[model samples]
Target: MSKVISRDGTIIEYDRTGDGPPIILVMGAFNDRSTGAPLAGQLEPDFTVINYDRRGKGESGDTLPYAIEREIEDLNALIAEVGGSAFVFGYSSGAVLALHAAVKGVPLSGLVLYDPPVEGYDGRLVHQLTELISAGRRGDAVEFFQSQLVGMPEQVVVQLRNAPFRPYLEAIAHTTVYDTKIVCEPPKQEELAGISVPVLVVAAEEMRDKFKQAAELLVSVLPKGQHLCLEGQSHHIVAPVLAPVVKKFLLS
Candidate 1:
């Protein structure tokens, strides 16, 4: 494990592997660096992969009165550690965060986003999650995210009530507020248009239609954007199938 201090003095922990061009993995909610370990392992043979814990989770440090810019700064710190530029791969809501960072002019060589949830986040979700977490109902917060926000059925939520990962989800439930705030107010199309770097928005064949539609729309809006839908894939990462596509794009 390695660390870099962000602009606001927060220590961000990361694992670095391989020895070539740099690529940083930015994960979504319900994830720490561990969620990205498999993909990192696959990419490390050809690219130097940096997998890190976003603030407020894993071994990273967090600051109170969180602002979205702080998260951008966290990513900027990582890019700086990699010599001021790197390719970035963001999954789920982390993809949204990456787009926002690119808009704000963080140095990036290219971007790859997988199955970004470009729609369906509630405008009032930040307030609701804050209330639940502040009231010490972390379990409820987790369930609210699973059922209401992510649209999991109640039966599925109930079935996973005692899941071994339930506690892990609840442990970082507070950061769900961070992710909700990020996706709830997505980047403007005009802002997206201003990004001058190459971007690839990827979707899975078996995922919801909305995901494919969102990828196509994002591609249309981005000046250098392209879209690809993988066969027999879903929202989850299948690193063996994905790593080659990412490698091709980054190398191109």
Candidate 2:
């Protein structure tokens, strides 16, 4: 793992692999750098993949009073580290984060977003997530995010209580609040339209209506946006299926 210092002096940890144009991997909630490992492996042959632990999760350091701008600054530091401009690929809420960073003028050659869950959310979710995390209800916080944000069924959420990965989910529950703050509100059409960089919004064919709509909405507003739906895929991304499509769009 490599480390970089953000503008706020936070220690950001990331793994760099492969040897071509750089592509930073931004993960969604309940994830760390490890979440992108498979995709990195698949794309390593053609892209310099930087899979990083978002602040407050994995090996990355977090400063108190977290704000979205701090997260943006973290991306900026990584971008500067990788020759000042590169492709950025964001998954789920990470996609939303990438969009926020792009709108703020973080230099990027292009963007690739997969199933961004940016629709049908509101500020109340931010408040709810914050309260849960503040009260040390980490497990509940994790469950709430899975149930509400990820739209996991109630029965499925309960069934996962004994799942082996349950502990990992609770361990980084605090970061869910950060993600909620990043994506609670849907993107403004005017703001997204200003992002001049080419964008590829990848959606899953079997994904729910909200997700498909979210992908379509982004493509509709982005000045240079295009949409692609992966057949037989859902919110769960298969690296082999996705990496090739991503390579095609990014290289085009």
lDDT of 1 by residue, 37-126 (tens): 999999999999999999999999999999899999999999999999999999998999999899999999999999888764768988
My TM-score estimates for the predictions, one after another, are 0.98, 0.97
For residues 1-252, could you state the per-residue lDDT of candidate 2 as single tens digits? 899999999999999999999999999988898889999999999999999999999999999889999999999999999999989999998999999999899999999999898784877988998899889999999889989888889999999999999998898898998999888855688999999999999888888576887778778989999998888897877999999988998998
| C-alpha local distance difference test of each model | 0.92, 0.90
**What overall lDDT, based on C-alpha atoms, would model 2 receive against the true structure?**
0.90
Error of 2 at 233 (Å): 0.5
RMSD of each: 1.0, 1.0
Off by over 4 Å in 2: none
* Colliding residue pairs in candidate 2: none
The CA lDDT at 114 in model 1 is 91
In terms of TM-score, how similar is model 2 to the real structure? 0.97
